[model samples]
Target: MLNGGMKWMFLILGTMIGAGYASGRELWQFFGHESVLAIALFTVMFSICCYVIMKISYETQSSHYLPILERLVGKKLTGLYDLLIILYLFTTTIVMFAGGGATMEVLHFPYWIGIGVLAILVVVLFFWDINGMLSMNAIILPLLIILLLAVLLLFIKSNVNAMLFDWMKQSNWPAAFTFTALNILPLVAVLSAVGHQIKHKGEILIASIGSGVILGGLSFLYNQSLIQVAHDLLVYEIPLFAILKSYPYYMVLIMSFLLWTAIYTTAVSGVFGLTARFRDMVNLPLWIIALIIVTVMIPFTTFGFSTLVAFLYPLYGVLNLYILASILIFPVLKRYDLLS
Candidate 1:
C-alpha cells in the first residue's frame, strides 16, 4: 500500500510540477512577491482539493474526466466544462512545447529543434501507453525534487537574510486561489483517468498529502530563491535559470537537462489528457492520435514560451476558479448526498 501510494504521489507531483511550475514561470505568475500567506493557503487548499477529486474519481472508478466533471458541475454544465477542459489541455500542452523550445533556446539550440525533440518524445511515449508515463514519473520526479531543492537550498544558504524580508510580505495571499485554479484542469484530466487504478482511500489520502507537502515545500523554497533574483527576471525568459546562473558550468548543464525533462513530463501529461479524451472517437491507436495532435501543435510553439505563459496561465487560472471551488466544496456536498 505504501509503495502504491508513493507511485500515485509522484504522479501528482509530476502532473503539477511540470514545464511551467518546474520552469518557475507558473509559480511566479501566481504566487510571487510577498506570497508567504498565498503559498501556505495554496498548500492546504491544494491538498484538500486533491483528496476530494481523487476520492470522487476513485469511487466512480472512472476512465475519463467526463463522469467526475459531470458530478462536480452537474449534467447542465458538464458539456461546457468538458469543452473547456479539452481546450485548456491543448493550450497548456502547447505552452509546455513552447517551454521546451525556450529551454533549448537558452542552451543555444534552435527553438524548433527543442520543440521537435519534445514532441517526438511525447509521441513515442504514447506508444508505451499510460504505464510508460507512470514509470517515467516515478523515476524522474524524485530527481526533479532532489535537484530542485538542492538549487533552492543553495540559494537560501548564500542569502539567508534576504528570506527574512521576503517572508514578511503577505499581500499576495489571494493569488493562491487562482494558482490552484490554473492547475485544476490538468489534475482533473490526469487523475480522473486513473480512477480504476486507485486501490484504497488511504492511497488517495497519502498521495494527496504527500504531493501537497512536497510541492508546497519546493514552491516555497523556489519562490524564495526567485525573489532573491527577481530583478533579473526581466532579462531572462525562464526565471529558474536566474537561480542557476551562479552555479558551476556542469551544474548548469545538469539543471538544464532536468528543466528540459520537466518540460517533457508536463508535455506528456498534457497530451495524456487530450489523447485520453479522444481515444475512443479517433478510431486509431492512441499513439497515432498523439502524434497527429502534437504535430499540429508544433507550429504554435513559435509564439514563444514566456509570452504564452504570461497570457494563458493567468487567464486559465481565472477561468478554472469555479471548478476549483467545486472541488474544494465537494466533500461537504457529498455528505448531504447533494451530488448523488
Candidate 2:
C-alpha cells in the first residue's frame, strides 16, 4: 500500500511541480513576505482537497473528470465547470509551451524552435500514451526536486548578507486560496481519470499528505530565495535565474535545461488531462486530438511565457474560486447527506 501510494504521489507531484512552480515565477506571483500563514493554510487546504477529490474519484472509478465533476458540484454546475476545466487545461498547457520557448530564448535559441521541439515531443509521446509520460516523470521529478532545492538552498546560504525588505505584509494570505484553486482543476482531471487503479484509501492519504508537504516546503524555501533577489526580478523573465547570480555559465545552462524539462512535463500533463477528457467523445485517436489542441494553442505562445503566466494565472485563480469552494465543501456536504 505504501509503495503504491508513493507512485501515485509521484504522479500528483509531477502534475503540480511543472514550469510555473519550478521556475519560481508562480511562487513569486502568489506568495512572498509574511506569507507563512498563507503557505501553511494552502498546504493543509491543498492536502484536504486532494484527499476529497481522489476519494470521490476512487469510489466512483471515474474514467474521466465528467462523472467526478458531477460529484464535485452536482449535475447542475457540472457542465459549467467542465467547460472551465477544458479551458483551464488548454490555456495552462499553452503557458507551458510558452515557458519552453522562453527557456530556449535564455540560451539564445529562437523561441519558435523551443516551442516546436516541445510540441512534437508531446504529440509523439501521446501516440505511446500516458504510461510512458508518468514513468518518465517518476524518474525525472525526484531529480528535479533535489536539484531545485539544492540551487535555492545554495542561494540562500551565499546570500546571507543580503538585506531583506517589505516582504512580510500579511494581506497575501488569501492568495493561498486562489493559488490552490489554480492548481486544483488540472489535478481533478488527472487524478479522477486514474480512480479505477487506486484500491486503498491509505494510498490516497499518503499521496495527498506527502505531495502537499513536499510542495509546501519547496514553495516556502523557493519564495524565501526569490525574495532576496526581488530587485533583480524585473530584469529576468524566469525568476529561477535570479538565484544563479554567482554561478558559472555552465550551471546556468544546466538549470535552464531543468527548467525546460519542468515546462515539458507540465505541458504533457496538461495535454494529458485534455486528451483524457475528449478521447471518448471525438471518435479520434488521442494523439490527433492532442495534436489539434496543441496546434490551436501554438500561436498563443507568442504572447511569451512570463506574460501569459502573469496575466492568465491570476485570472484563472479567481475564476476557479467557486469550483475550489465546492471541492473544499464536498466532504462536509456529503457527510451531512446534503449534496443530493
Candidate 3:
C-alpha cells in the first residue's frame, strides 16, 4: 500500500498534470509568455488555493468539495456551486480532447484518432478504485517531471532568452486575469475529488503550493527556451511538442507519451467524476452511467483541440473564477461554522 505522503504526492501530481498543465496552454493563457516571476506569483495564488483545499480535506476527510460549499453557501447557493463545478469539469474534459488532438496532429496522426484513443483510455482508467487512481499519479508525476525538466534544462543550457513576461505585457493584464480566473478553477476541480483525504492538511497545503511555485519557475524556463527557438515554436500547432522534436527522433516517442498521459489522466478523472455522480443519481448501474457519459461526450471530444483551448477556455475560466471566489470566501464569513 502507498504510504500517506506518497498518496498525497500522487494526488497533487495527478491534479497538477491535468490537461492544462500538460498542454502548456494553461500557462500560455494565464501568464501569456511565462515570466519566471509572474508564474511564481501565479503559483503562489495556486498554492494558497491548495492550502485552502487541504483545509477542506482535513475538515471533511472523505467528502467532495460541493458539500462543503453547500454548507458554507447554503442549499440554494450550493446548487449553483455544484453547477459551476460541473461546468469546470466539462470544460476540462473538452480541453483534454483538444490537447490530445493537438498532440496527435503534431505527431502526424489524425486528430479524431487521437481523441478516440484517449477517450477510450480514459473510460478504461475510470473503472479503477479511487485509491488506484491515486497510485496512477506515481507513474504520471515522475514521467512528466523528468520529461518537462529535460526539455527546459536543455533549452537553458543552450542559452535561450526567456520572453514570457515581455510577451505578457503585449497581451492585456485584464485579459490575462480573466483567463486566470477560468483556468485556475479547473485546477481546483482536479483536487476536489481527493482534497479531503489528506492526513496532514498543513503539509499537503505547503507541498501543493510549493509545487505550484516550481511549476511557475519551470514555465519561465520554458518561455526562455521558446524564445531561443522562436521559429520552431511557432511552427508546430503544439509548441511544447515542437520543443521535444529538437531532441533525437527516439526522444520524440517519450515526449509524445508524456503529453498523452497527462491528457488521458484528465479525461479519465473528469469522465469518472461525471459518471460516478450520475451513477449515484436514480441508482443507475455504474457501467450504464459510464456508457451514457461516453455517448454524450463523443461529439464534444471531436471538436478540434486548439479551438477549445483558445476560444472556449476563457469563457469557462470566468465561470470557474466566480465559483472559486465564492467558495474561498464562503468560509471566511461569521455566519458559517465548518465544524457544524
Which is the leading candidate under lDDT?
1
lDDT of 2 by residue, 1-340 (tens): 9987887888888888887888888998998777777888999999998899899989999878999998878899899999999999998999999889888999999999999999999998888777878787888888888988898778878878432434456677898999999998999999998898898999999999999999998887888788888899999889999888679999899899889888888888899999989898899988899899999999988788788889988999999898889988998888899988
Ranking by TM-score: 1, 2, 3
Segments of candidate 1 deviating more than 4 angstroms:
165-168
For 1-340, candidate 3 gives per-residue lDDT tens digits of 1356555555655655666666665656555443454555555556665666656656666345565565445677678767776776776787787788777776789988888787776666655646556667767877787788887787677663443244445433444345445645444455555655666645674566556666666666665666555566455556676566657877777778888888776676676566544554657655556566766666886666665776776777676666556545654653465433
lDDT value for model 1: 0.88
Worst 10 residues of 2 by lDDT: 161-170
- Give lDDT per model, in order: 0.88, 0.87, 0.63
Instruction: Name the lDDT of candidate 3.
Output: 0.63
lDDT of 1 at 26: 85
lDDT of 2 at 4: 71
Candidate 3 wrongly placed segments (more than 4 Å): 1-3, 71-74, 163-180, 229-234, 282-288, 327-340
TM-score for each of the candidates: 0.97, 0.96, 0.83
Model 1 worst lDDT window (10 residues): 160-169
